[model samples]
Target: MYPFLRMVKELIKFRNAPAMRVGDIHISEHRCWPWDIDLWAELNNGRTLTLYDLGRIPLAQRAGLVSVMRKNGWGMTMAGVSVRYRRRIRTFEKIEMHSRAVCWDDKFLYLEQSMWKKNGECANHALYRSAITDASGIVAPERVLSAMGHSAQSPEPADWIKRWIEADAARPWPPMQDKR
Candidate 1:
């Protein structure tokens, strides 16, 4: 318990660090591969940018960014994402990505990420929201509050799951464009 408390303190401090230019947070610094691009294309609905693809970048860094957060008493579960594509990237093109923890509450963690070309032009930007959850998928807000060393009580879980279900039901899959 003491170790958990200490880790939580460190994570809170790290999250509060001053925001710097996107160039400061270096990613893997590897050249974009064709396979990666193809995966990106498929996940982005054949668009230039894909949230699923970008989400995987952190994994390639070997930084264990997400795992570290989890081990340090931070619950992590994807909440929502919004990505905007600026330009198309071709195969073999060198690109860079920047990521940072923007903000968080007892229930949610927010992050901002962006991709740039060799010329330093922004190619894509994304906002990712995640929440802390226990092994049973139940969010333990009190754990976050305790970790933060805050006296305030945790709020009830938001109806996010309900909203998600409703939204999903509202948008049925489109019919197959090409029938066999």
Candidate 2:
């Protein structure tokens, strides 16, 4: 058995340890600082949490998740991300964010996450996909499986690889200009 398999077996035993959650949003208290205002202001005419600040929650959560996998002797690299904002948040408003792993295939792991206002309304949602890799950043498929406590010949297949490739091909070169 691969050394990493032991860690995977342990993780599986406590797989449902807990639902990961994070965050609390802070709205603007003053408008004197234009630079700060510009950074936080949203297209919907409400102040937003700066990307720098909003990013902290996910960064910490990702670090924690990565630590879990690493402790199991598994390493991974982030591959793609998609975020959607549902409602405009203004100053003095509070929002809560939550994150959790939904599933994983042979090559990629999928995370489902969300943000909500104090009122319990969803403010945003996001999905993060990551690829398993080796210390050298090489895609070692069989190694990844073994690290996850699966047999080297596990039947799991990677469907996202094709989709990621096709999406890369179809992506536009540059974003469209805003006429306003």
Candidate 3:
């Protein structure tokens, strides 16, 4: 089930946060709840991804991206992701989430986020490709930035992210048919 209550709590917690630039980092604290654990008694991989949202939404809010979306009737969606889980996160363990926008391409924005343990070890990290959409289709990142009252000029995406995008582009859309 979606943690709508938690969502509201986080939203309210960061509501008054100062606006941030695209590359500015947003730090958030969270705990691994019992319900968030899996059979092995660690934070579930799926749950980890969902928990990332708690960090990202606040990032968008602080960056004023949410305001742009609201004003322009635009929406944001996850187009792709590459995540690495480095360590186990035990139940009730506290984590610090760090999130920031890396850069933007013609049609997508790239973001990087990480969950860190109190000992300074990284538990997980992810690179995300997000698209802004409206009634027509994907909106250009420059346009989205403009709507957010930001400069149209965008920094180039990281080489690794650019490689991933290229790899994704080469993949077959419908996939191979099963030879049953």
Count of clashes, each model: 0, 2, 0
- With a 3 Å backbone cut-off (N, CA, C), the pairs that clash in candidate 3 are none
lDDT for model 1, please. 0.50
The digit string of per-residue lDDT tens for model 3 on 1-180 reads 776778789899999988899889999999999999999999999998899999999999999999889988999999989999999999999999999999888889988999999999999999999999999999999988887878847777778888988999899988999999
Q: For candidate 2, what is the total of clashing residue pairs?
A: 2
lDDT of 1 by residue, 31-143 (tens): 45555456544213233334333423343122334443456654456666767778766667766766654544555545566777888898777666656676566354445
Which candidate, 2 or 3, has the higher TM-score? 3
Error of 2 at 151 (Å): 9.7
Per-model TM values vs. the true structure: 0.50, 0.46, 0.96
Order of quality (TM-score): 3, 1, 2
Candidate 2 lDDT, 1-180, residue by residue in tens: 122442344345434444332222222111122332334553232222223123323333333544545665655556666667787555545555555444455566555555566677877665666566666564554454454444435333236634654575598767688899
